[model samples]
Target: MSLNYPAEGRNYIMDAAIHGGQQIGTWYVALYEGDYTPQEDDTAANIGARATEITAYTELTRPELVESAATGGASDNTGNLAQFTLSAPKTVRGFAVVSSAGKGTNTGKLLAYQRLATPRAYAAGDVVKVPVSLILSNPA
Candidate 1:
């Protein structure tokens, strides 16, 4: 099974109507080891897995990152699911989309996270691939 939209993120986005400084910047997909867990007090700084994050697969640099489709952004089901191929062995349990390319509390602000229903354990010589789609839309 794949990841579902998180309640933490749902609350955050819902509260944005009353909040003033809540803004999502560039989105980058970050893969974590099977041991990583999503935390409520997560900041951008320490978002990477403990020495287990795939470096090249950590910060996916893309032009049309992701934004709120409900607010005149891109349409749904259109290039929203990001596809990634593992070049090396990776025991991935979950992934996230962040705001920056750098790390640390002030830099690596995580926007969303999802844990795979089944872990993806890829070997060095294996062709591993997964699609992580960001669903940014209205509840209506």
Candidate 2:
């Protein structure tokens, strides 16, 4: 899934790039099962407030995002797909990238989110793999 970096995310890039803000050492991907729509104003806390994060997974924790170098103005975790083995039945609607490594924690920046083209219902033991990307480009 491709990312749509929210306002906070945009600012984070600018800050880390030019304003001396601390660069995030690592970012994590979290899955959500709530009925929620991503907005430009959404933050990590905002997402946590509106969405029900899916934490019943067999994985030890949320997957860490390892991005490739940007080419053609895009970078992605294609080589390192986030894999989740569901421990319980759930319908997953979307995912978000956050600064925190702790599952269900809201304290951090919300980098981006993408609601799936279609929500997927998964049974326990089903594996879900996600590859995420970020693209930066000038407006045409």
Candidate 3:
């Protein structure tokens, strides 16, 4: 899936890249369930309010993102998949990477988000697997 980096994400990248702002060492992945569409101004709080977070899983507290090296200006967690074992059935619409590790908490910078091309419904014991990625390129 394609990822959309919000304003907060862009600024965070710039600050860590050029400025002296502290770089984020780890980011947590969260699954969202709703009809919410990600916007440029979307934040952690905004998303938490707009969508329902799927927290009925067992695995990493919040799936830690492990990305591959950037090649051709793109990096992804292809081999390092985030697997969530659902304790209850839910329809997952999308996912977001944030700075917070608490489930359903609205206290962190929303790094990136992307709605799934097709929503997926899971059974009570289903496992949801996702491979998150990001692409950086100059404007044409």
Q: Could you list the CA RMSD of all candidates, in the order they appear?
A: 5.0, 1.4, 1.3
lDDT of 3 by residue, 27-132 (tens): 8899988888888898888887777788888765778888888899888889888778998898999999999988788987899998999999999889888889
**Which lDDT tens digits does candidate 1 get at residues 31-109?**
6675766666554455564424554433344223443354343232244544445556778777666666542223635
Q: Which 10 successive residues of model 3 have the least lDDT summed?
A: 51-60
lDDT of the candidates, in the order given: 0.54, 0.87, 0.87
Which residue pairs show collisions in model 2? none
lDDT at position 21, candidate 2: 90
Task: Give TM per candidate.
Answer: 0.60, 0.93, 0.93
lDDT of model 2 at residue 18? 97
> Which residue pairs in model 1 clash with each other?
44-104, 44-108, 44-109, 45-104, 45-105
Q: Which stretches of candidate 2 lie over 4 Å from their true place?
A: none
Q: Could you tell me the lDDT of residue 84 within candidate 1?
A: 47
lDDT per residue, candidate 2, 6-58, as tens digits?
Answer: 89999999999899999998989999899887888988888876878999998
Residue 17 lDDT (model 3): 90
